[model samples]
Target: MTRSTLPIWRRIEFTVLLAALTVGGGIWGFVELLEVARDKTAHSFDTRILLAFRTPGDPSDPIGPGWVEEAMRDLTALGSTAILLFIVVTVLLYLLLDGKRRAALFILLAVAGGQVLSSFLKLGVERPRPDLVSHMAEVYTLSFPSGHAMLSAVTYLTLGSLMAHILQRRTLKIYVLSVAVIATLLVGISRVYLGVHWPTDVLAGWCAGTAWAMLCWLIAHGLQSSRARPLD
Candidate 1:
């Protein structure tokens, strides 16, 4: 039988298993990347990839036309602290007003906790911003895992999964989830294009951020399964 056709409890068990696997894999990938990032042994690889986005001789001039740079900056802002906070608060308020208090609280805890965790990781790693190219976008924080990348994944993925859960149609659910993934990816790429993050920084951000989101889902699903009937 297809997974969706399984007994409700069986489906829940399968989902929990998949999410746990994802969390474990993400954590493992992030740790391996972290060691490379810490040792600076990946400098050559990082530099080569970073420069690929710039003109052959001009690291200051990103490879795109002027408008493209502006566009990337705009894309990058979608992951900014201000934008993410606004999105989270808006969603939280909507969920509360709609009587989904549990969901609202979960979103708040997931995003806010992810933000705090990202800060701790950055501070602990103390990796410097990439100096291989002139930064096209302004930045003030220390760089290890790109904050924009990690937070975007955390926020968007959490929101996406919630959206998937709410939608009635399978296609609609897939569409929303795809949009979330694409948005998260674009933000990471924009950071590289803007020369604000090393390639590994973005990779680590994606790994950790995805793990955090999945971890949140696993917790929520487990709690819900415990409280609800098996048929639910």
Candidate 2:
């Protein structure tokens, strides 16, 4: 049969395959980054990127107009714990009110579990914040994998995927998913630019978070698909 004639379930099967590949890639990337995090090359790379955002003569001043720095700070805040919590609570409330109690609970648990995972990874790695350049933001935590980057990816991607499932229009679904990806990238970049996280930290965070989000999606999708399948 031609592509246009393929059943919707076939398309869903393709998506499941793709998501599985993504999960594997993300996990592999995270592991490789973890292995190299303490090496000389990684250190050099991290410092070079961190200092690139700073003025040549002074690492204290970022290489940008004042407003640029301010904007970066604002972007980084999008991934802040407080902001993320607020977003989650709002979504949970909406889902519950809309009689999607199961979805609400699943989302809450996913986000909360992601938060816990991030914390555990931080403790396991115990990497210190970058000191090669002046910090543009205040931080008090280990920095192997950036919590901002990881949590933002987890929260935004999870919400976006869920929203896409509910949205009827293909265009709307794509737009929501795109926004989630862009938001996650911006948050990670902001962390590096602010000299609070090493480049590797953000990369590792992205890998771990993407893997986690995709895994959750796979599980949920599988459960729903099984329920919808007709008895043989």
Candidate 3:
């Protein structure tokens, strides 16, 4: 009846309920952002937020020390396709070498699926990058949902959760997940600061990314539980 005495299935049920809520909320938020993206008047928030990062009368010069720009660029690279792919490759190789084929495969499918979904949504929305200000970062993709933000969430959060599942200590689990969340946040914020994406784009990316990552986690959890048949 108490927390310590609760069955494993019961704990899993709780997690399922939470993940369901997260997915539903994320979908709802993305829909709302999509509607806002279509409304011209509603884009004021994006303009104001983007311009705030620039100098008072100059869109070309961002308002900050030189190092700040460098830092933002570094943060942006953390979500770059090249960097994310490298991380994915390294993790997959490690898992495969350690004989965690199932986990490795799940990572591959989750990240690849996220890339596909990001592309589909970008084409579906066909939103343009913010032109109200000069872009500090070069981007060639459609911009409703920031791909960097989304993919970063998909990669870091999925890997973080997986690491948490592997580690034994509760503190370590929390630390790993916290770092993942922070990295995701920094990537999203960097997109906005660099004038490459509207704030709504980043928001939608975070929502969708979080939802996808959590759903994948739930699926992996179910698979793990099913495979670990315990004796009565």
Which candidate should be chosen as best, given lDDT against the real structure?
A: 1
lDDT scores in order: 0.87, 0.86, 0.85
- lDDT: the better of candidates 1 and 2: 1
Off by over 4 Å in 1: 1-13, 228-232
Assess candidate 3 and give its TM-score to the true structure. 0.89
List the lowest-lDDT window of 10 residues for candidate 3: 223-232
Candidate 3 residue 3 Cα shift, in angstroms, is 12
lDDT of candidate 3 at residue 96, scale 0 to 100: 86
Which model, 2 or 3, shows the larger TM-score? 2
After superposition, the stretches of candidate 3 with alpha carbons farther than 4 Å from their true spots are 1-13, 228-232
lDDT, candidate 3, equals 0.85
lDDT of 3 by residue, 32-71 (tens): 9999887755487888888899998998888899999989
Residue 55 alpha-carbon offset, candidate 2, angstroms:
1.6
Off by over 4 Å in 2: 1-12, 40-42, 228-232
Write down the RMSD of candidate 2 (Cα, Å): 4.0
- Taking the tens digit of each residue's C-alpha lDDT, what string does model 2 give over 1-232? 9866888767657778888898999999999989877664447777788889889979899988999999999999999999999999998888888877777877887788888988888887767777788889999998888999999999998888866766679999999999999999999999999999999999999999998888878877776668642111
Assess candidate 2 and give its lDDT.
0.86
Per-residue lDDT of candidate 1, residues 1-232 (tens digit) = 9988988777666667888899999899899888978885557879899999999999999997899999999999999989998999998888888877877877788888988988888887878888878999889998889999999999999888765665679999899889999999999999999999999999999999999988987777666657552112
- Between prediction 1 and prediction 3, which has the larger lDDT? 1
